[model samples]
Target: MTKPFDVKIGINPISWSNDDLPSLGGKTPLSVALAEGKAIGYQGFELGNKFPREPEALRAVLAGHGLELVSGWYSGRLARRSVEEEIEAVDTHLTLLAFNGAKVMVYGEVADSIQGTQEPLYKRPRFFHPEQWRDYADKLNAFAQHTLSRGVRVAYHHHMGAYVETPADVDRLMSLTSESVGLLFDSGHMTFAGGDAVAVLARHVGRVCHMHCKDVRPRVIRHARNRNWSFLESVINGAFTVPGDGSIDFRALIRLLYDNDYSGWLVVEAEQDPVVAPSYRYAEKGYRYLRDLVERVPLEAAREAA
Candidate 1:
């Protein structure tokens, strides 16, 4: 039967080897991660630190594992840099993504971000003035428009310790930016940021071009919140986990995506200590859970229609 929504399954390599915390799964090879993820039936993968930067080499490596390049994260300093400088910085990474058939580039605003640091999560940066938001959006609009012209769209990622961490922040950013600046709706981050993923998706479904199906442990998040832990500290304490292993309702999330006719990659991204969670095991679990949900959604839709 044909599916209700057009979607592809992908996984971020952070589960195998984290980019921010090198020591977490740092010893794991890129090849092993790719092979195991491909074996779990992931159709694509997001770029990781260890992945070859050369487009041709990256292509060959993914081709070997029968996986497509689903796009990668771009640390955007558009909040502080001019549009010209931001565009110049993204050139090489953008080329790699476009060459590998990725339609969207995951853009995370890292300017003044405490995500990679030991600063408490409560210490996340914020835009205190209206002009700050406007200036940042103007720069982002120009940059996203430029990238869209080059074939790949920019999907803004609302991260934990960045300026755009809260639901209100996402709403504000979406209101300020043009349609060219698509939203990268990440469920885990949304939940961790005290927002309902379903509600957020419903509100910005039109602007959402990519998705990160990340799940979080509520108890860990509560502990982090109570103790005022850093983003990295929370991650180390197992704040994130694969779908079917955490609190987020994937069935409801997928059903909403199907209802909205969402057509893009649903990337499974959960940063966890590989030694504690076991990368391949959690990868397989997440893959099977999402695969089942995706398959079941269409059947449920047809039944309802009948």
Candidate 2:
């Protein structure tokens, strides 16, 4: 049975190789990653540090594997730098995305992020004072305009250690920026940040242009809190995983998106050590989990109609 709307499935290479901590899967070649990803039934892929930076070269590699370059991460330092500086930092990445015919660019503000570090994760990320919020939001609006001009959309990623990690942070950002700036809703991060993923989705579904289907282990999360683990430490302690293998109810989440007419890429973005949880196996598992969610109810409806 077909879904009522188009929702392509994609995966990130971080499942295979941690870009921040290269030691995780640094030895895993790009060729192997592309091959395994295609074999696991992913329709698209996000760019990783191992991927070729040149648009044409990257396109050729993806073309051979029958995959699309859906989107890639662009670190924006808008919290401290000028909008022009932010734009300049992302210009090359935006150009590559534009040239590759990708429509969305995931913008993660990394100026004060502790995502890659082993620092204590119990404290809240840096809070944006009112004046700083104004500046940051203004810059994001301008950056959205620039991306829109290039036939791409900027999807602000609310990540765990980044400044905009919590639900309130997301609300503040949405309120400050123009409607042109879209959101990249990640369910796992929301759960990790101690927020209701379903409610957050409901509140900001209109602004969401892309999605990341990540799941978390409650026990590891509890342990992380108890042990004062860092973001990377939590990941190392087995806090994250693909949809069904962990605690997130992806079915309920997808049903919400389905009912609300949500469409576009649903990316599997669980960053884990490849050795403990093999990449291809987890990729296949995540793919099946999402495939079931999208098809489960719709197929039953189709059968009843028949």
Per-model lDDT: 0.94, 0.88
Tens digits of per-residue lDDT for model 2 on 231-281? Answer: 989988788999899888787788777767887999999989999999999
lDDT of 1 by residue, 205-240 (tens): 989999999999999999999999999999999999
Q: How close is candidate 2 to the true structure, as a TM-score?
A: 0.95
Q: What is every candidate's alpha-carbon RMSD to the true fold?
A: 1.0, 1.9
Location of the lowest summed lDDT over 10 successive residues in candidate 2: 119-128
Q: Could you tell me the lDDT of residue 70 within candidate 1?
A: 97
> Model 2, residue 2: displacement in angstroms?
8.0
Worst 10 residues of 1 by lDDT: 1-10
